[model samples]
Target chain A: MATIEELNKDYSKENNILKKLTSPGGLKDKITQFQADLDLAVKDFKEKKKKKEYALSRNDRATADMLEKDLETIRKNVLDLRDKIQKASDFLANQQKIVDEKFEELSKDPEIKQKLDSILYKKYDRKKKAELNKKQQLETIKQIVDAHPNIQKWLKGIEGYEKSIRKCDKIIDKYKATPPSTPEEQKDLSDAIDEKNHSTKSLADRRSDLVDYFAKNHPEIDKNILENIHSYGNIDRQIAGCEKSINNYDKAMDNLSVAKDTNVVNQTSPSSLAPVPAQKPSWFHPIQRLKYSINEWRARRTQNIEPNPIEPNASAKSTFLEDVKLSKDEYNSEIVQKYLNEQYQENLHKVARQKGNDSNERGE
Target chain B: MENDFINITNEDLEKLSLEELADLKIELDDLVSKVNDMLKTCDDILNKDN
Candidate 1:
């Protein structure tokens, strides 16, 4: 039978083991997670193939383009996962190195382990709690969004209109071969023809943009458009509550009012459409304040000189060109071919001169 | 002479003709199938032991 003190000591050891095991630099860890996103991409590709084979020129092509965008998203997710893992590992290594150096420094003090024992490993636990809360909030917010009638109506409207666009493509392909018949048919044809004209950057292009946005690099874009795209369901909520209603206060309008007053998303990042700067992190690092300020000292001493890029040599330029439409062999051989042509012409001129000299000798 | 797997770059893959992607696609599919088979075998063993 263990005493309360003994139980506490046992539990502490167990927690320590878990901490060590899950630590960023541990032999076994959860910090470096391999993503299943590429597998999802493969599944998307397979599903797209099936749709292509069966759907022919059906309205499903729009859906197929969306699926391709989904594949791109999955690819970007895998890349992001890898990048995060690499960054975590690098940070862990740097911290461990600093700790090792500090440990050596602290060895002279003789009470280093006692000091280290006071520190608790609770950051991952806090991160987990935050994640759980965010997920719960996202679900709660999503329900609020789904309850909006306009959003539901708008989503439903998309498929029917998108179907019209796809039908237009098929009809244009067919109608071009055979002329228009009825007056209604002619009108439909005209609309489809217009959709076909400027529709290259249509729904699919916007979808691809979304995939790129939630992607690995997450390149910057027009915030308004990104917000509109991401908040597809949210927009529906806004419209149903505030702008679209019969009374002085619409449901869409009411939601929009709440949105303006409150920071809707705890809005943790710069990517947030509506930003609250109080919670914002500093753009530069802070730890330099506590330390000897290496950056400040270096800034005073060092010149702001940029390193020069290597200039390409004539031979290397001919041998290895970046994004050259022509191949290395073709470009090199073309130059050689030109030189040969010039040399051949020179030889012909020399031969004619010699013949004239021989003719003069014969005349003498 | 043996070649390491990492010798190929993304640019090389991009430059490959459709015929080349088709050839690599076959190889990638085979590798993916083998990986799936191995995963299933390991899962079965673990399940039985557990």
Candidate 2:
């Protein structure tokens, strides 16, 4: 058995070895420090969770979905309104062409030309003043008779067409208001517009057929009038209304704050959003135990040093003590398992690199 | 008792008497238990939060 002096020397030497393996800058200190940080993170996460401070709710999700649906419906309705207005304008242009043709046919007649000349009055000459005055009064009466028979049908058709166009303008005004939210409300508005459009289509088709009938009956009308037909009047106001309604819908969607429906709670802790963990976890628990044991052993040494303030007789201690050198082979044996694992991993890396090089050579 | 000092290198153990090594082994076992308790407590607290 070793004397107290020998035991103290061995203890000091063991402490030096332990300190080398486990002090602040050593591997054990790094591992324990990481574990301590992880433990602190766990505590922080728990405290935050208990308070429920960062709870995410799906309160406005349903409302947002419903609003989006309504906006989609509004977009489709605005496009339909534009298409309907375009078709109506095209129908109106076609009708205007037929009316112009009828007027042209009447104007081309010799009798109708003579009537316009008489109504407008020929250049008055001072030499034939009495003759012109008597003739002008008779000419006005003749002009009225000529106009009465011609252009009456053409004038009536245009008047009716203009009245229908005014009705379309009123319907367009109603369409620019707030669109329906529910399917039932949408159907009601849709059915009303469909009924109005169907009637308008019927009226246009009938009027166009009538114009065809008139042209057939009055074959003297020039065919060149067909070439003169072009789009007429302004649908610019209706186009602007459609654009404004679309913008209004877009603004409404933008203003809405829809809560995100996420399963975030199940995935990770809300406290995890603070920042990435500062410490790397050294997952081995045996290293942790070894670290604490080393600390306890060092603390005992400090306690021993504090009590023995007087210097020991170092010369007398040296006479009995032998200088010791810890073998490197023995140190290696202590961590043999770790050494073997490192070698195995190194071998695996070499094998993988060799395989890669062989495959590259094969490709060449 | 032998297994308790498994992490302590055999070369370091050769410097001490069997009694001293046994004492250190017991201390190490106590430390292992304390560390295990700490780790278990952390896990339990985290699980409770879930």
lDDT of 1 by residue, B1-50 (tens): 00211123343344444333333332232223333433343333223221
lDDT of 1 by residue, A258-332 (tens): 234333323322242332223223543333221223334335324542243223235323322332333445444
Q: Model 1 Cα displacement at A280 (Å)?
A: 33
Give one clash count per candidate, in the order shown: 11, 0
Q: What's the DockQ of model 2? A: 0.01
**How many backbone collisions does model 2 have?**
0
- lDDT score for residue A233 of model 2: 15
Question: Model 2: which residue pairs collide?
Answer: none
The alpha-carbon RMSD values of the candidates against the true structure, listed in the order shown, are 31.4, 50.6
The DockQ-based CAPRI class assigned to model 1 is incorrect
Error of model 1, residue B46, in angstroms: 27
lDDT of 2: 0.40
- Residue A213 shift from truth in candidate 1, angstroms: 22
Native-referenced DockQ of model 1: 0.01
Looking at model 2 chain A, which ten-residue stretch has the lowest summed lDDT? A226-235
Interface RMSD of each: 22.4, 49.2
Q: What's the residue-level lDDT of A186 in candidate 2?
A: 69
